[model samples]
Target: MTCLPLLASASGAAIPLALIIPFVLLLMLIAVMPLMVAKVKHWWEHRYPFVAIGLGLLVVVYYLLRIPGGGETIAHTLEEYFSFICLIGALFTVAGGIHIKVKGSATPVGNIVFLAVGAVLANFIGTTGASMVLIRPWLRMNKIRLGAYHVIFFIFIVSNAGGALTPIGDPPLFLGYLRGVPFFWLIEHVFLIWLLVIGLILAVFFAIDFRAFKKTPSAVQSEIGESDTWRFEGGLNLLFLLVIIGAVFLPAKFFLREIVMLAAAAGSYFSTPRAVHAQNEFNFGPIREVAFLFAGIFMTMMPALGYLEQHGQEFGFKKPAQYYFAAGSLSSVLDNAPTYVNFLELAETTVRAEEPAAFAALGDEKHAAVRLLLERRPLLVIAVSLGAVFFGAMTYIGNGPNFMVKSIAESSGVRMPTFFGYILKYSLPFLLPILALVGWLFL
Candidate 1:
C-alpha cells in the first residue's frame, strides 16, 4: 500500500512474459467479444466482472502459490486499485448530482463552443468530472446530428488532451503530483504542448462537425423546445467537487485523500434530490463496470509493470520521445496511471544515475525522489505526462473515462463503436496521424 519500487529488483531483469497473458486476454475480451457475438454482447457487458475476476485470480494464484515476491506485488496493485476506484467513483457520483439543461437549436458553432468550454473546464475539474458534467448536455444538444464521431472527439478533447494542464485533470498527472512534483510544474512545462494538441484537435473537430452539420436536414428541432436558455440544478455539488480538489491539493496521506473524496461523494449523494439524478440519467453502472474491470487489470499488470520499471532502460528509452511512445503504446491498453508510474520510476533511475548531486540535494525523503526526477528531465516528464494522457484515447480501457463516456453515450442511444472497431477504424486512422505529427513537432 505504500510507495513501491518500479522494478521487481534494482538489478534490472524482466519478469516472465507469461505474466502478461491474463492482461492480454482481458483486453481481447474487451475488444473482440462484443463484435464477435451480437446477442451475447449485453451478456458480455454485464458479465465482465466474472471474466475479469477469474483471470485476475489465475495470476494471483500463480504468484501466491508459485512466486516469492508475489505477495508484495499483489499488495501494491491492490493499493493502486483502491485509490483508482475511489477517485473515479467519487468524481462520478459528485458530478452526477449536477445537471445542465439547454433550450435552443443545436448549431455547429454552439456545439463547438460547448466542447471548447468543456476542454477548459477539464483542467480544473478532472477529465472524468468535466466529461460526466458536460457529456449529457453535449449529447442532448446534438441529438439530431448525432454520430460516433461526436463521442470519439469528445474522448479526444474533454476526456484526454484537455486534462494536460493540471494534476487533478487526469490520474497520471495526479500520481505525478502525489510523487512530489509541483502543482504548477505540470501546467508550466506542458502549456505549449497542451495548447498545440488541444488547439489542433479542436480545429479538426470544427471542420468535421461543420461538414456533418451542412449535410443534415434543416427540419431537425431542439429537443428541449425553441427557447434559448441554460439552467443548472444541484449546484451544491460544485462545492463538494471543490472540497475533493482541496483534499487532493493538501499534503495529506494517500488514504486520507481517498477518504476526502469518498466523503465528498457521500455529501453530494445525500444532499441531491432524486429528480436531479433522474435528469442526469445517472446510475452506478459505468462506475461499477470500471471498478470491476480495472481491479483485474491492476492485479494482472503488476509483474509486467514491475519488470518494465527495472529493465525499461534496456529497451532504448534513452530519449524523451522513446519514453513517450513506449509508455504510451502500453498505456493504450493498460491503465495509464500505473503505466505512468512505471515509466516515472524507470526514468527516475536514469536521472538519479546521471545527476546524483541534484537528486541528493533534493534528499531521499518520502516524496523527494519524484521531486528530483521531475527537476532533472523536463522533456522526459513532458513526454511521459503527454503520452499517458493523449494516447489513452486509443481504446475504451486506455483511460478510465473512455469507457464511462462510451457507456453513457450508449445508454443515451448513441451507438458507440465496438472496441476493435473504435481502434482500427477511428483511432488508427484519425488519432494516430495527429499523434505522429505531434511527436515530430513536439516530442
Candidate 2:
C-alpha cells in the first residue's frame, strides 16, 4: 500500500505489544497456510478472505474504541487501500486485455534479453503494469522447460528491483515524488546502483538458466533454436495503459485518480474482443484475492506503523547502512511503500533532532526539511529508496506486484514456491547477498 499524509499525524503514546498480535498472526498464517496439509490448504484458500477481514476488523474496532485520533487513521488507511487496489485492479484489467504471443521457445540468452527489456520497461509503465503485460508471454516462451526459478527471478528483477529508476516505476517512489522529491531525482541518484544490481541479478539468473538449458534434451534445444516470432493483439489497450500511468500524477481529490483508472479499465474491458480475453485467459480471481488480502494488511498494520513512528529513533539507527538494512528488513514483511515512507519520516526526524540549528536555518518553506535532508544527507534517502524497492522482492506480500505475479504464474499452472519456500530458496540464497553487497559498497 502507498503512504498517506495522515500517517505522519499518528502521534501518541506507543501502541501496546498485544495490539500487534493480529498483524503478526495474519503474517504467520499467510506464510504457513499454503505449506500445510491439503485439507488445511484447501480451507485456507476458501476462507482466507474471511480470516483476513475478520482479523482486520478486530484491530479496526480496537482503534476506534480505544485510541485517540483512530478514526482519522483508519479513514486515511482505507483511502490508501482504495487508491492502491484501484491502480492494481485497473492495471490487471487493462493488461489482461492485451495478449502477446511468442511463437518460439526461449533460449537462456533470449530469456535474459527478455528480462532485461522488462527491467527497462518497468521504469516507464511501472512494475505492476510491466509484470501484468509480460508474465503471460514470459510463461508461454519458457513453457517447455519452465521452472520455479523462472518465476522467482522474474519477481526479483521485473516485479521489484527493475522499478527503481522513476516515480512511476513503483508506489514507494511515486509517494516519494508526491512528498517533495523531484520526479527524475531517483534516476539521477540511483542509476548506477540500479544498473549494477540489475546486471548482477541478471548474471545470476543467466548462470542458473544456462545450466538448466543444458539439461534440456537435444530435440527441445533444436526447437528452442527456431526463429522467434511475436504477435501483438488488443493494441488499443496501450492507450488505456497510458491513461492509468498518467492518472498517477493527478491530484488525489474527489477520487479523481481512482476514477480515471477505473474508467480506463472499464473502457478497455468492454472494447476488447472476446477472443483476446480468452487467449489471455484473463479473469478477476488474482486481483480479487489481492484486494481481499491487502484490505486486511492495510488495516491490521496501522498500529504496527504507529508504534514504529512513535519510537523508531530509540532503535539507534544513525547511519546509512543501518537505514538500508533496517528499512529493508521491515520491507521484507511490511508493505514496502509504507515502509519507505516511515523510514523517510524517521530520517527527517533524526536529522531535525540531531541538528536543530541547521534545520531551523532552512526556515518554513514548503518541504524545506526534505530539501535540507537532500542537501546534507543524500545517502539516507538513497538507502531508504533502494532498501524499500529491492527488499520488496523478499516476499510475496512485500510489494503489490510480487503477490500478483505469483498468483498469475500459479493460475497458469506454474508450481510456485510457498511463502517460506520463496524466501529460503530464492530471497535468502540469491537476493539478500546482492543487496547486502550493495548496501556495504554504496550506502
Candidate 3:
C-alpha cells in the first residue's frame, strides 16, 4: 500500500501491545509454514489464505468495535491495498503477454550484463515491472544450471536495490514524491550511493556465478557462449505497460488509477495471442497469493504503524545513520511504503520539536514542513528513503516484487530458499554488509 493515512488515534493514546499479536503470528506462519514436514507443508500451502484472512479480521473487528475513527482507518487501508494489488496485477498480466527468447544459454558474463540492464530498467518501468518483464528470460537463459542463488541475487539487484534512483523505481520513494519531495531529488542525492551499492552487489554475484560456471563441463560452457540470438514477441504489450506506469501519477480518489491499471491489463490480456501466453506460462496464481497475504499484512499492521507513530520520537533518533538503520530494520519485515511514511513523520516531528521557531516561520504553506526538512536536514530524508527501498531485499514479504518473484520461480521448478534461510544466507551475509558500508560512508 502506497499512502496509508497517519491515524488520528495515534496522537490521542498508545495502542495496546496485545493488538500486535496477530501481525507477529502471521509473520511467523509465513516464515515457518513452508519449512514444515511434507504433510504440514501441503496443508499450509492450501490453507494459508484462511489463516491470513482470519487473523486480519480479528484486528479489523477489534478496530471497528473498540477504537474511534477505526472504520475510516480500515477503509483507507483497503483502498490503498486495492491500489497496490491493481498495479501489481496489471504489471504481471502485461509482462506475461510479451515473451523474450534467447537461442543460447547465458554465460556468467552474459548473466551479469542482463542483471545490470535490469537494474537500470527498474528506474524507468519500476522494480515490479522490470522484475516481471525480465524474470522469465532470466530463468530461461540460465535453465541449464539454475540455482537458488540466481533467484536470490535477482531479488537483491533487480527487485530491490536497483530501484533507489527514482520515485517510480519503488513504492516508498513514490509515496515520498506524493508527499512533496521533488521528482529529481532522489537521483540528485542518492546516485553515487546507488551506484556503489549496485556495483558491489553485482560484483559479489559475479564471483559466485563464476565459481558455479567453472563447475559446468567445458563443452557445455562453450555451447553456452556460442550464439546469442534474441527474438521479441507481442511488442504491443509495451504500450499497455507504459499505460500502467503512467497511471501511477493519476489521483487515487475513487480508484481512478486502479481502474486504468486493470483496463490496461485486460486490454493486454485480450489482444495478445495465446501462443505468447503459453510460452510465458502465464497464470494468476502468483498475483492471487500476493493479494491474499498482503491483505492480512495491510490490515494487521495498523496497530504497529499506530504504535510507531505515537512512540517513535521516544527512540531518540537524531542522526541520519540512526534513521537509516531504524527504518531499514522495520522495512525488512514491514511493507516499506508505510515504514517510510512513519519514519518521515517521525523525522518531521523531531525537527519541529527541536526548532519550533524555524517551523513557525514557514506558516503552513503546503508541504512547508517537508520542504523545511529538506532545507535543514536533507540527509534524514535520504536515510529514510534509502533504508526503506534498499532493506526491502531482506525478506520475501518486505517488498511486493520479492514474493511475486519467489512464487514465479517456484512455479517454474526452481527451489527457492525458505523465508529465514533467505535472510541468514543472503541478506545478512551479503546485502546487510553493503548497506552498512553505505550508511557508514554516506549517511
TM-score of each: 0.86, 0.86, 0.86
For candidate 1, write residues 1-443 as lDDT tens digits.
33455324433444677787887788667656655566788789878999998889988887776666667767766776776677778888988898997765567677677778888898877898889898888887777778998999999889988898888789888777756678889888878878877777778888888888777766653342364468899999989988887876554555887888889999999999999999877889878877888778777766666665556567666788888888789789867876787787778777867787887776546655576666667778888888888999888878878877898899889888878899988889888788778877887
Lowest lDDT 10-mer window, candidate 1? 5-14
Against the hidden true structure, what lDDT does model 3 obtain? 0.84
TM value for model 1: 0.86
| Clash pairs (backbone) in predicted model 1 | none
For 1-443, candidate 2 gives per-residue lDDT tens digits of 23333243445545886887888788777756766899999999999999999999998998888887778778878887888778778877888888887765588888989999999988877788789888988988898889999999999999999999998788788767766787788899999999999999999999999999999998888876365578999999999989988888788889999999999999999999999999877789778887887788778878776665566578788899999998899888867876787788788767766777988887756566567778888898999999999999999878877877887889889999878899999999999999999999998
Tell me how many clashing residue pairs each candidate has.
0, 0, 0
Q: Candidate 2: deviation at residue 334, Å?
A: 4.8
Cα RMSD to native, each candidate? Answer: 3.4, 3.4, 3.3
lDDT of 3 by residue, 41-105 (tens): 99988998999899999999988888787888898778767776787678778878988876656
